[model samples]
Target: MTHPTLLHRARVLAQRFGIDITRHPSDRTGDHLVRLLDRFEIDTVLDAGAHTGGYGTLLRGSGFTGRIVSFEPLTAARAQLHRAAEEDPYWTVLPYALGDTSGTIELNVAGNAGASSSALPMLPRHRAAAPGSAYTGRQKAEVRRLDELWEEITAPGERVFLKLDVQGYEGHVLRGAGDYLDEVVGLQTETSFVPLYEGGPLFDEALGHAQRELGMSVMSMVPGFTDPDSGQMLQCDLVLFKQSDAREAALV
Candidate 1:
């Protein structure tokens, strides 16, 4: 929670960008996100970690009127996410996980549900950072490459913005997209500085692939999680834009 005086100042700052942070101070951050999407003319979003529609809800509340296609693998979470978007004509929810390959995979369901669920095993550092993020159990879920469902997730002439919040499985999601990456104009992925999930790619590996191999350039990065005691950075959400050169060449 932000201090009252600090939060009020944040709201005042956000108003400069024509944003109202009274609803959610975090929504103030959406000003930058909205600007980036608008810059790319993005009108569609591929939400990899739908997780009860929290991200989509935030985006819509922040004044984005784009079509949102959300992916959630957990049965319980998908049910809630579906209910949340049931009345929204532009929002759609899918019950599946995206990975490097298509098949069934075991997802570790976190005790707290949405925030910590992942295909990879949780590490000690994760528990140390967030004690409530312990795995409760595992469930087998359908996994597919984003490319395989590209047509279903997107519509014609809709520039896509991809958001990957898949605990530590963002690398697998990116690998699965492969050539489909060309269709995305921008992306926001959560990367970790410390190992939170076993066998998951850290910030360098994930950022390297997106920049060097996928032709995305870093636009912004916001710290996500930090150790309360040591104040050590644990995770961050990285915003990236597809290189103009790749965009033009791909368009050709």
Candidate 2:
């Protein structure tokens, strides 16, 4: 008996099921980021929880010519991040996690890599949806306060943009960024509508924290993760800018 290859089997199955797996949300979300970049006149970016430097690649490919300081907590991802940005003078990757305070934190490394790895644990719902995202192990990552690194990461007069894809730890990162929120013009963050990770904030709480407490307003939102079976949105990425008279003027 001969076994069919995975690609061949998928093609046959797709024809039978009328499925299209080629859809990508980045085509839309990437456009949104570019518009926000231009609208805010952003020249610098703070990329938190950058995995394998994917976001950096997206920014460069989308024609963004600015300085990007990316922070990754995992060892393997940081190694990949270094290689990905080696040729780009404006892109730099650091081997540390950002949190509410400066210290060491244990990261639950996921076997799937795209799964949640945070101070909190994964709940049953997330585990069931993506069983391969099981915790393979744990690693102690050196954490840094974004405020302490702000001076070193940016030029003297640069207006900053912030992107947070820190799984379930977005709130912790935002808490740490309070001291320098005024310097930032825009923010993009991932929020989950459901309880994906144990102790993780829901979508409303996370968005409210940024809007009400951090002085940011949601400008646009795009679908992030989705359930292929039910066609339900699991997560989304929000584009936000600081709420101030200056921001209103810039948009006008």
Residue 90 lDDT in model 1? 94
- Please give the distance, in angstroms, between residue 93's alpha carbon in candidate 2 and its true position after superposition: 0.6
What tens-digit string does per-residue lDDT give for candidate 1 at 1-252? 856587767754543332334555466777778777766778899999888998888888778888999999999999999998999999988888999899999999887655689988889887766666678889899999998999877887778989998988887898898787887888899999988889878899889988987788898997676664465778888998878744434544
Per-residue lDDT value at 171 in model 1:
77
User: Estimated TM-score per prediction?
Assistant: 0.85, 0.88
Can you write out model 2's per-residue Cα lDDT over 1-252, one digit (the tens) per residue? Answer: 989777656644442232234446466667768877977888898999898998898888787898999999898888889999999998988988998899899999876663356667887766655565667899999998888888889888788999998878887887787668777788888989999877778889878877887688888987665554455677888888887738567667
Which regions of candidate 2 fall more than 4 Å away from where they truly are? Answer: 1-21, 245-248
lDDT of 1 at 181: 80
Compare the candidates by TM-score and give the number of the best one: 2
Clashing residue pairs in candidate 1 (N, C-alpha, C atoms within 3 angstroms): none
